[model samples]
Target: MSIEAIGAIGAVEAVEPAALGVPAAPVAAPGFADWIAREVGQVDATLATSENDLRRLATGQVQNLHEVMIHMEEAKLSFQLLAQVRNRLLDAYQEVMRMQV
Candidate 1:
């Protein structure tokens, strides 16, 4: 399924930065921006579903606490993955800036 479909299934809402009155950063390329946006959307959807599952478990709507714990761990792993990616990007930018012209 596409990112949008997954988001819809998870009932995740998209918030535009501009709509929130935040200035948008200029993307180096449209395709790159779209790819990043899709990944972010997927992460957001997963986190939302994980949170909902925890809520359900807390309210006794769900029987298995293990499932909620698994989802929470998955979200944590995804967040770590995103953090690594960000770190790598920052390192690359720093390397480029330090290059002798």
Candidate 2:
């Protein structure tokens, strides 16, 4: 291809946002139940994986201490994050219930 054609291709590829002609919508925040469910699911998956690794380790299927430790840590962090989310949700519910009509 010629240099001029390459330059034109580059120019077309660098189109500005205005040229797209569509406004982005504002993002909506997730509800408390939705957030809790997502966090719970993540923690559940992590826990399941850790359990599987532990089983494998017991059966002499895999022998990597570092890998087991990493999986354990991941499960721990996920559980901690889920617990915090649950506490926040409970606090919000209590605050709403205490509101005077």
Candidate 3:
């Protein structure tokens, strides 16, 4: 028997960068910017897919209600995690900005 507490953990790992005009990651030894960009791009992709699924469901194109709900919840958790990351980063940046030289 298997139980899924939060599906977002896996979903967060499933995004690939399509809009960046560059390879997804590690093809050229990814840097910090590359890593962050890839993460954001992937989360964005997940959110986009979730949104599309919602639209399809509303239009009766989706047959599995449970699957759609799972996807939506994953997207929600992913977004919340992303938001927390952003907040922490911003806080760190502000702290750095306030530091004395």
**What overall lDDT goes with each candidate model?**
0.87, 0.86, 0.85
Ranking by TM-score: 3, 1, 2
Best prediction by TM-score: 3
Candidate 1 stretches greater than 4 Å from native: 1-30
Candidate 3, residues 1-101, lDDT tens digits: the string is 34564665676654557665666565566687888888888889889989999999999999998988998898889889889988999999999999999
Give candidate 3's TM-score.
Answer: 0.67
* Tens-digit per-residue lDDT, 23-95, candidate 2: 6565788896787787788889999999999999999898797898899999999898778877997899999
Scored against the true structure, residue 88 in model 2 reaches a CA lDDT of 91
Measured on C-alpha atoms, candidate 3 has an lDDT of: 0.85
Q: Is candidate 1 or candidate 3 better by TM-score?
A: 3
Q: Report the C-alpha lDDT of model 1 over 14-57, residue by residue, as the tens digit.
A: 88999999999987666866887888888888899999998898
Please report the TM-score between candidate 1 and the true structure. Answer: 0.67
Write down the worst ten-residue block by lDDT for model 2.
Answer: 9-18
